[model samples]
Target: MERKHFLKSLLVGAMSAPALLAACGKDDETVAPSTDSTSSGSCTVAPTETEGPFPTKVPASYVRSNIVDGKTGHPMTVKITIKNANNSCAVLSGALVDIWHCDAEGNYSEYGGTGMQATNYQSVHFLRGRQITDANGLVTFTSIFPGWYSGRATHIHVHIYSASGTSLKVTQIAFPEGTGSAVAAVNGYAKGMNGYTYNASDNVFSDGVTQELATVTGSTSAGFELAITLNVAV
Candidate 1:
């Protein structure tokens, strides 16, 4: 979704735009190997971006290694390795990573006063959580295929914090169009296929998404796996 939609979804009591266009998790079932890596010659830091407007400041109860929180859709396994850009992109362990995204219908949990979908969902917290990176600087989240809103492709929001709880980086991750197209064919995500914008036209990813796109694998039947190396300055 565009920045404006994010603001409207989180700021107002209701939104006039398409309900599915409104802006908006983790589990520890398994530790998937990192399918994405940075070569020795090219280990630049992931591009920093906004944290999106929908992030809640409420205390999160779902801070364990698993963050699925019972929400349902095509399963997605997200594994990200946090690295210190100042240290030649070496893995930086124990940093805190917070990730959140909309559900299959594009409505964000813990925040729904905007009348995008559920009204009583304002206090509900699903598909939003945090996890501390392991010794390998890896954190995994089990989530669902994210739904798309107007002006944006399928993506996820990430915020990395230092071990001292200081914010280090804010960025978004995108999925390849092919991945999105395939997921859209599924039951819940079909709505996202319409009016969906590609990466080149998305305001946040227009510059380029090579560094922000996750290396996604698997399928809608068995679920998908997304892995990426998030290099940040410590």
Candidate 2:
């Protein structure tokens, strides 16, 4: 789908332009996950992004590491570390991290048959899961490399909460430079990189992606690994 058509569909779906922009994520990029921070040990708080339009309505029901429930694409291992910005970037154990994203065809599960997404995946949950941080403040999810949509870039939505269930931060992960190639290599999906939007033009990532950028490695044949550390003010 072209960008304009997607935007028109969103408008017809009762989502305004500003709301749609606020609800999108970023494009692809590559880097190595940092140990202490997004870059160096700066401990900058990851920016708060939107969680709307298509969030997991029942995250507690899907507390598993493998979220790829029958979806096809390059295998992706998503490793996210949560850090406490108030405590010198210490690993925040026991935080709740929930993530959801579109499948290889740029369509999200639990949401379809609408103007925003014509695919009917509303009855199934494919790429959505939740996990609690371990002692190392890390949560790993086995998923597929997400495809891009017309108005937004290739990205993932993340919602973090405390062990007690208090919402901490809501954000998205951005990919690096090699994402375009990865998308093109995927088997399913007719779009490929034709209408894919880059981070520079992505409404959710145009300003900057310093904190949201993730380190992506591996090949389309072997799959990919993504690692990102999110700093939250606790």
Candidate 3:
């Protein structure tokens, strides 16, 4: 369904989802440190990742902070801080950050592909958006918890651009196994826990998800907060 129709169909459901979250008292928890231990100096830059099969250029109108205006699924806040890997990881302000992910049903918005089961959503643009980094080199988006699809673990695509709108780096982020499993159990997730894939088994993260896995806090009932720092040669 296109975004307009998609939102219309779910308007009532969207209005009530927040109340469910509040009733459950799901609050933010601090993200665990990466499993792979490394000092700041020893850590290499965040791995360069594939844009996957559904990459799209977010239109200016879609370049807003909240990407989940009328979308379903548990709420999540994703914050990315851009940094210069060569400059003692100094924050890089003014970078353009674009992010996209699938809805709770494992269907993406704005791009159509064989990987995505919903062909009707080819032209639909829902969970797709971008934002500019602030003085703290941070860009945040309000999105819903993403659903799982075959052949891949739960993940989100990210693209970084210079303040001039020039591309700087492209990569992706994944949720911890515990969080993925927890979120899958929520009301709207169709895939359920059985549909989840751990970082070791996922085709993209199997090589290693040490840096790609985001630190997630919060719960299924209330929502989740995800934070990941992107190290680039900005």
TM-scores for all predictions: 0.79, 0.83, 0.76
Sequence-dependent TM-score of model 1: 0.79
Cα deviation at 134, candidate 2, in Å, is: 0.8
lDDT of each: 0.69, 0.78, 0.67
Q: List the residue pairs that clash in candidate 2.
A: 28-175, 28-176, 29-175, 29-176, 29-177, 30-176, 30-177, 31-215
Q: Please give the lDDT score at residue 4 for candidate 3.
A: 15
For this target, which candidate reaches the highest TM-score against the unseen true structure?
2
Minimal lDDT window, size 10, model 2: 1-10
Q: For candidate 1, what's the RMSD?
A: 7.2
**Alpha carbon lDDT of residue 112, candidate 1?**
65
lDDT of 2 at 102: 89
Clashes of each: 6, 8, 1
- Tens-place lDDT digits, model 1, residues 70-125: 87788888998898866766688989998888877777777666534444467677
Residue-level lDDT of model 2, residues 113-186, one tens digit each, is: 96667899989999999999999999999999997777677889999999999988878898885436554456
Give the RMSD in angstroms, all C-alphas superposed, for model 3: 12.2
Q: TM-score for candidate 2, please give it.
A: 0.83
Per-residue alpha-carbon lDDT of candidate 3 for residues 138-161, written as tens digits (9 for 90 to 100):
999988998866556778888888
